[model samples]
Target: MEIRLAGIKEFSVADGPGIRTVIFTQGCKNRCKGCHNISTWDLNGGYIQEINSLISYIDSICPNKKVTISGGEPLIQYNELKYLLKVLYKKNIIYAYIQATI
Candidate 1:
């Protein structure tokens, strides 16, 4: 499956405890006041990426690193996120959390 992403941070400490890789998914409905990632609001703006490639990049960095699936709103691609989580889980990758905006 493919994913739309605003960006990917291969290595991040601020995202979670221990080493972490953050996937910044694209698209969001809620445009809250003073949003830092205003560019992620557009559903068509970011580049399309394959899920496998993203996982490969994460794996190449380290084994079983903590991952945070953050976005303007990650559930925007609910099915894709579900698949991504499954794959990550199989590889012993813990999903640290979802950085949700309410």
Candidate 2:
């Protein structure tokens, strides 16, 4: 599955406990006034990444670091996100957190 990604930010402190890889997904309808990621609001914007590639990138970065998923809204890609979470859950190498705007 191809997912719309705003960007990948590595080694963030405020996102979660310890160093984390943050996946900022694209497409958010919420349009909150105080949204930090206002640039990712457009669903048409951002790179389209395949599920496998995303997994590989996350795996490669799983060097004792957690994986935090944030975005315009990850639940917009619910099915794909679910799959990715499942895989991450199985690895047990990276902790995962999904920050929902809702």
State the TM-score for model 2: 0.93
Per-residue lDDT over 1-102 for candidate 2, one digit per residue giving the tens place of the 0 to 100 score: 888999998878889898888999998999898888899899999989998888888889767758999998999999989888887778774668889869
Off by over 4 Å in 2: none
Residue 72 displacement (Å), model 1: 1.5
Stretches off by above 4 angstroms in model 1 are none
Clashing pairs for model 2 are none
Candidate 1 lands at a TM-score of 0.91
Whole-structure CA lDDT of model 1? 0.86
Per residue, candidate 1 scores C-alpha lDDT tens digits across 15-93 of 8776778899999999999999999999998989999998888878755578998987899999999998899889888
